[model samples]
Target: MTTQYGTWRKSRLSEANGACVEVARSLRGTIGLRDSKAADSGPILELTRREWTMFLRSIRAADKIG
Candidate 1:
């Protein structure tokens, strides 16, 4: 699927500690993720809505466990 992404935005919680990520939504409703530090040259990881939700849940669960 050809994706046309909307505005990519970084999380406000990401301070200058260097662990930054940016996220955007494509016109077709997929999620786009990239490293904010290398945004212009880095690779993007796109995911469907379901994948995005699952990814979030897994990470949150892992965070709680760690």
Candidate 2:
């Protein structure tokens, strides 16, 4: 859970006020997500590559319908 991540980036679709979430890709094929406002202290969400792919697909599907 405390693995060092690569470059952290926010989605281009993030809110203008900077209340956004950031994602990082680790070398081990895992993804890490954290609150942009608490990069240093906030807890990270770690997900395997497969899980991340599913999560993204679900979001895209939701966007298309909702």
Candidate 3:
């Protein structure tokens, strides 16, 4: 079966300098994410729903963490 990659959306925290990450949805139940700079060269990280939530939590707590 062919895999379909959905449109990529930039993060709301992105700046005007274009330094941000793009995320896309794959045909499977995985989320695809890549760097905005080296899109094609950068490796994509596919994460499940649970993993994604955990990642979000980590990012939210980044500032609180030492």
Q: Can you give the TM-score per candidate against the true fold?
A: 0.87, 0.90, 0.80
Minimal lDDT window, size 10, model 1: 11-20
Please write out the lDDT profile of model 1 over residues 1-66, one tens digit for every residue.
557799999977787987898999999999999899898888899999999999999989999999
**Regions of candidate 3 where Cα sits further than 4 Å from its true position:** 1-3, 64-66
Q: What ranking of all candidate models by TM-score puts the best one first?
A: 2, 1, 3
Give the higher-lDDT candidate: 1 or 3: 1
**Model 2 weakest 10-residue run by lDDT:** 1-10
Which pairs in model 2 have colliding backbones? none
Query: Could you give the C-alpha RMSD of every candidate to the true structure, in order shown?
Result: 1.6, 1.3, 2.2
lDDT of each: 0.91, 0.92, 0.83
Better of 1 and 3 by TM-score: 1
Top-scoring candidate (TM-score): 2
| RMSD in Å for model 1 | 1.6
